[model samples]
Target: MKLSEIKEILATAEGVNFKLENGISVPAHFHVTEVGIITRDFIDCGGTVRHEKVANLQLWDADDHEHRLKAGKLLHIISLSEKVLGMEDLEIEVEYQAETIGKYDLGFDGENFLLLTKKTACLAMDNCGIPAEKQKVEMVNLASASTCTPGGGCC
Candidate 1:
């Protein structure tokens, strides 16, 4: 999900809820500790330079169990972050602590925002010499007694 889309969704939502891909929900009292734009500029293994930017929302569970982040409040915080940090309509990456800090891709499932698990991918599969998947074929026994022998002209 993009920052603009979340802002639009927040306009109509009453509560801000985040769920993990595993159906586990982030604690209701979780705090969005930081909202900022993250820029990554690096070289891929394929020897190509790449640049990426994402809107990052860092979620933290605090001791204050009574705290709740309302949709409007989150929207306001997003707007402030945008105004102050010059954020763009980039894809949102959420950082939440599970057993450890995990980064997730943001998504919406009509009712709630989902933190989709992120996986590592190779950017240079072609250059890395990784073998392509081989096609499989079933073998049929054509050497049956009814079949012509190889010495026959039918070979």
Candidate 2:
């Protein structure tokens, strides 16, 4: 979700909670270690120049189990980051380390903020010469008895 959207959601939530797309919850004691704007500039395989910017929130499961980030506190931190770093209202990307560090897109259900699983996508599918997936057909459901027999000339 966008930065503005989260701000509104935070206003109503009791605390900051990040729910993973797999139905796992990032514990309330988790610390938002970093909040900064990330700007990535690169050239796609299609020879197109691209730039991306997002507000990043890095969550770390800290040793202090009593720490629970409240919505208001997070909002204040965000504001401070904005003022100090000149950050803008960009989409939020969360970085969390489970088995390893993974970047995710941010979202929220009615009751919980969500960390969506990120996947690699071809930046230029058309230029890569990868064919589109073919439509699936169920062989068992088709009437193919005539074509199966050796004497069925229709084959």
Looking at model 1, residue 57 earns an lDDT score of: 96
Model 2 ranges off by over 4 Å:
135-155
Tens-place lDDT per residue, model 1, 1-155, is: 89999999999997889999989998999999999999999988989899999999999999989999999999999999999998889999999998899999999999989999999988988888888779999776676755677777776
Residue 123 displacement (Å), model 2: 1.6
TM-score of 1: 0.86
In model 2, the worst 10-residue window by lDDT is: 141-150
lDDT of 2: 0.88
Encode model 2's per-residue lDDT on 83-128: one tens digit a residue: 9999888999999998999999998888888899888888988887
TM-score for all models, in order of appearance:
0.86, 0.84
Looking at candidate 1, the ten consecutive residues that score lowest on lDDT are 139-148
